[model samples]
Target chain A: SAVISQKPSRDICQRGTSLTIQCQVDSQVTMMFWYRQQPGQSLTLIATANQGSEATYESGFVIDKFPISRPNLTFSTLTVSNLSPEDSSIYLCSVGRRGLQETQYFGPGTRLLVL
Target chain B: SQQGEEDPQALSIQEGENATMNCSYKTSINNLQWYRQNSGRGLVHLILIRSNEREKHSGRLRVTLDTSKKSSSLLITASRAADTASYFCATEWKSSGDKLTFGTGTRLAVRP
Candidate 1:
């Protein structure tokens, strides 16, 4: 099992500003994933961050909007740019084991409210 | 869409009663997983059942998958207030690489 933590557990930002959410894992992981959960909705995969390479984003999401940085094996950051009321959601980070079917360990998540 | 759909969007039941939720996907999957989220926080993975497997159980939770129908069911027995949370079913499809597409989710409220 891996222990995960995120910074700025909850934040309220201006509509046009940007907020960077950091995710840290206790152990070095090969892959880390970012997710968004809007109010009264299920989790949506935003992107997958891997060290030494660019992140792979899902459909309806792009790097320009949600830029990701994976500086090392245990750390990654996701920036929500040009925030808006519709971007008010819980951003979560998770670390998965080697196999695709392995269970993923998730961080508490950063609650972002764009005003 | 590629995402799956879960039935009983909201469920309210007594603490001792059982709660059952169903999920239906559109494509063939290599595996299906169940996760629980408290309030709006991060998700906690509960169980994973492979395509070849029919059923899996952990603690008071039981999951059954039917590939013929592309659907799965989660059953929680003797529930408690702590069990009140949103349950989601995620699938790893054979075509999609490495990411799990989540279902609509079911909000279960266990009354004490």
Candidate 2:
């Protein structure tokens, strides 16, 4: 299992401001994903951070709002642009094992609050 | 819409008793996994059962998959107060992307 960490564990930002969450893994991983969890809700996949390529976002989410960058195998970042009250949620970073059957490991998470 | 739906949204069980949660998915999946989240934190993967595997056990946790019914169940034996948290079942479809589709989750409260 890979040990993952996210920077700035949490932050409170003003509406219209932006914050970038960083994810770092102990070992190089093949897949890294970003997820969002609303208050009292389950996780929803935001995008798959692809190394050296553009991130593949899920439906209803756009890159303009959440831009992702995966420059290397061990690190990735998700920037929430033009934050709003609705964007106030826990953003988590998880890494998957390399194979057809996936075993994912998650970081603590970055709690974002837009006030 | 969530690909998976769990029943008994909230469960209250006493310590030392067994806790059971059921999950039903809407699509065919390659594998089903169970995860635990405490206080809305990141998910901790408990166990995973492939479509062909009927059951899987990891320590006090047992997971069963019924592909015919498109459902799965997670049972925690000898529950403890520390087991009080939200449990979720996520699905990886056979023909879908790499993302694991998550369910609504069941909030379990184990009282001492």
lDDT of 2 by residue, A36-79 (tens): 99998888999999999999999989999999999999999999
Per-residue alpha-carbon lDDT of candidate 2 for residues B1-112, written as tens digits (9 for 90 to 100): 7568998899999999999999999888889999999997778999989889999999999999999999999999999999999999999888765679999999999999
Q: What is the DockQ of candidate 2?
A: 0.74
Name the best candidate (by lDDT).
Answer: 1
Q: Over the stretch A1-115, how does candidate 1's per-residue lDDT look in tens digits?
A: 8999999899999999999999999999887999999999988999999798999998899999999999999999999999999999999999886565777788999999999
Q: What's the count of clashing pairs in each model shown?
A: 0, 0
Positional deviation of residue A43's Cα in model 1 after best superposition, in angstroms: 1.0
How big is the positional error of residue A105 in model 1, measured in Å on the Cα after superposition?
1.6
Cα miss at B39, model 1 (Å)?
Answer: 0.8
